[model samples]
Target: MTGAADAGAPLLEVRGVGKSYGSVSALRGVTASVAAGEVLCVLGDNGAGKSTLIKILAGAHAPTEGTLLAHGVERQFASPRDALALGIATVYQDLALVPLLPVWRNFFLGAEITVGRGPFRRLDVAAMRRATRDDLALMGITLRDVDQPIGTLSGGERQAVAIARAVHFGAGLVILDEPTSALGVSQAALVLRYIARARDRGIGIVFITHNPHHAWAVGDRFLVLRRGTSLGEFGRDEISLEALTGLMAGGAELDALGPELDRAASARDPA
Candidate 1:
């Protein structure tokens, strides 16, 4: 736990955050927070500035305006490594695992365990394998073999592994990027379960997705974005899944389009 955890502040929070690329504003005045053991769901359609927000949080890009608070103190992340050092990790949709590598290898990819000292130092393969298997099991993921290539696993399984890896690596806040977008219904359900598991373990989660149903399933709070601006942020109890979906899909726009669509249909079939 960091100072923020002890002080009872959100594990991660962005207050009035905004980003600009030259004259184009990609995001503006977005405020949200994720406390330990909570999941904040960010929902948006394409060109809604979700990616820009993710980059800011992940430290790949700095915010042009507003504040980023980690644990209670306002801080600017100079790089992704700075965020990682503070126990913040982002798992993008790609999973960041090498397709040809074994599951256990991928789990300990950058942070490997070694034995011996000096010239005799060598990778502790056996130990890494056991740890990976146990950690995955702790996250409710069971694999037939830890030696199999990560590419052989299903999308859901890969996501589960990534989440488990982040948890094992001491991430207090994990930002997930559209983790279930391309997954099947059942696969998406599995990933959501793992997210719940992470939340239960007292990890703060930022779940970025376009699916309101999935967001509603595991989110404690929701932030809806459209065209680089926030519609609003609401607690789970304050909004229904339908309402969230409507906001994400731009309800007012859809309502206006409905009449035009109906007229077009009638034009094509006038009895």
Candidate 2:
């Protein structure tokens, strides 16, 4: 494996990635690339290898076969922490917020700020609150206050907070798994707005979702997966929403279903 700053580098690239469990193939020869400040959306139906692809990228599981290049260097991450250290962070659907904890506390949970002298060092509550408030506001998420419990925030707000937290923590590449899957239409829209905000901040994002509409809303590039393989990948310029939806749901099969149904109806007509 090469370092992340090698030649012909993409901000993040997975070439010919494959994953298998015993005799089951979870992924097969999937390849994709995401550049800086771009949103690469991976769209797939349930069991279409989306999770497998994400795990590989997050370094949760090494691809049975493939090369992962970050910042142009080939690298293999031994664990999720390894990936995070390289500035890659993953936000799963759960949001991973401690519901009982205060918003500010959850924001700075593992990486708390401290200040004061020597043994007197104490949690920098004021600094963390002010920063969290500002960061969330910058991402278009307004909180009543940072002292409230995280569970009080809407799903979209929670997701936005997670995104802001990742960006503030120096994540160069953020992989989001179904960030909007559990939200309603308007709530999902709010989360999507924050995703765009993150991209505007120059952090490359990999958005994994089953909703083509949501994917199209924030995606600069699209990769459609099916049956553990890539159906295709297209730039926004190369594909439309209708085309993408058709592909994900089996275009040829859909086309054939209509005509076959029409033929059956004609045969049943009495002259």
Candidate 3:
């Protein structure tokens, strides 16, 4: 496992990071940082380059420009395994889980616990179940059965399991890609609570979402993006939920359309 980062340096830092594909640029000069025990929320609309940023951070793609620093030292990730080796884990919207597999199975999918030697080696089912239950409990998730199919759990519960798996395996930084996008209010709140729980445990998180309310609920800092460019990075005290919402919805553009919208409304009502 990687050691603690230098004091005052973020666990992960992107300095002027940019990505391009021949004639097109997917990201440009975007910068952000996530420190231990901090939640850095990345907010943006559909085409705001959030996916692109996640890919770069996850080592699925290389940036065309700028530097990525882990533990205050500059480095480039060759693949997802490289990022994983540095204790960086990403949980995307699809979750990469098998619907038929039990909760504990999915929790230790790629990294399973085993016992014995050579040909006698076998999966430690009991140990995995115990650890899965204990880890999820640490995140305030109490499952009735870790043996149930993962698909049997609610959306929020599945997300919580993914997070617990990352934390259990020593992930220092976790990048969550729209984990609560498709859930209802109560379900979304459950995931947000888990996020806070992870933060309290001193894990760095990059939470990507389009919802300002969700972001504000667990974020220590906010980074707003639009059309592949970064608007700015703000601390919790530096920005309000309202301002963040306005930015996500294009405040200037909305202001320009307000008069036209009012005219249209009056014409339709004529009252």
Candidate 4:
């Protein structure tokens, strides 16, 4: 059995993973990998199997075919908690934070820190607040006070909080789904900066998004999907932003439509 002590092993591995619901197949033979301090960005349009793959990884659903490996050992998670216990934390676009709750409280919502070594245990509010502030700052997030409600923060700040929460809970692999989809350009860049900060801390990240631009920015590896199957995978050294975007949208299709699109635009503009 491969344990967490295996330094050379990948943090998570999806080998030939597939899922189906009745006659509808959601995924097909998807194989991907992530290691410490790396970002594996998964790109695809809606209904292209991104959520299905996340479900499998998040332990919300089991793959009908293929295997999930953690640290080189087969792992079949019966529930999301099982995945969490194995140091895998998934943060979706709709973050789970209770908007009205204080930032520190939300940070330690489910897993609260306690004082007293023995039976006189008590909730450690001061410690949690201090820790939350420090952790958030580690990701370049600053808050005026830890006692403020989480809802008062901006979208980017909330995303950073979720990330910091995950890391604080001992997660080694952080799977983020569409983190920057709803943000403006500057906010998206803020999230990307935090992603890089996470990488610097040696946590492997699986970033799932439909935005080719965001994926190409901080991603170390890229996996593009179409029709529920990966079109291809590319390393940082293998592709640039322009090429990656072209391929993500089907390069051949883009090329074939270029002249026609240009003609249509010219006709409309009379220029």
> How large an RMSD does model 2 have?
4.1
Writing each residue's lDDT as its tens digit, candidate 3 over 57-80 gives: 999999999999988878799998
lDDT (CA) per prediction? 0.93, 0.91, 0.93, 0.90
- On a 0 to 1 TM-score scale, where does candidate 1 land against the true structure? 0.94
| Reference-based TM-score of each model | 0.94, 0.91, 0.94, 0.91
Whole-model lDDT, model 4 = 0.90
Look at candidate 1 and give me any clashing residue pairs: 4-71
lDDT of 4 by residue, 150-259 (tens): 99988888999999999999899999999999999898999999999999999999999999888987899998887888777788998888887887777899899999
Q: Over the full model, what C-alpha lDDT does candidate 3 score relative to the true structure?
A: 0.93
Alpha-carbon RMSD of each model: 2.5, 4.1, 2.4, 2.8
Q: Worst 10-residue stretch by lDDT in candidate 3?
A: 1-10
Worst 10 residues of 4 by lDDT: 1-10
Residues 1-271, model 1: lDDT tens digits:
3544445889889999999999999999999999999999999999999999999999999999999999888889999998998899999988899999999999999999999999999999999999999989888888769999999998999998999899889898999999999999999999999999989989999999999999999999999999999998999889999999999999989988999989898889665
Where model 3 places Cα greater than 4 Å from the true spot, the runs are 1-7, 262-271
Where is model 1 more than 4 Å wrong at Cα?
1-6, 262-271
> How many pairs of residues collide in each model?
1, 3, 0, 0
Model 2 scores worst on lDDT over the 10 consecutive residues at: 1-10
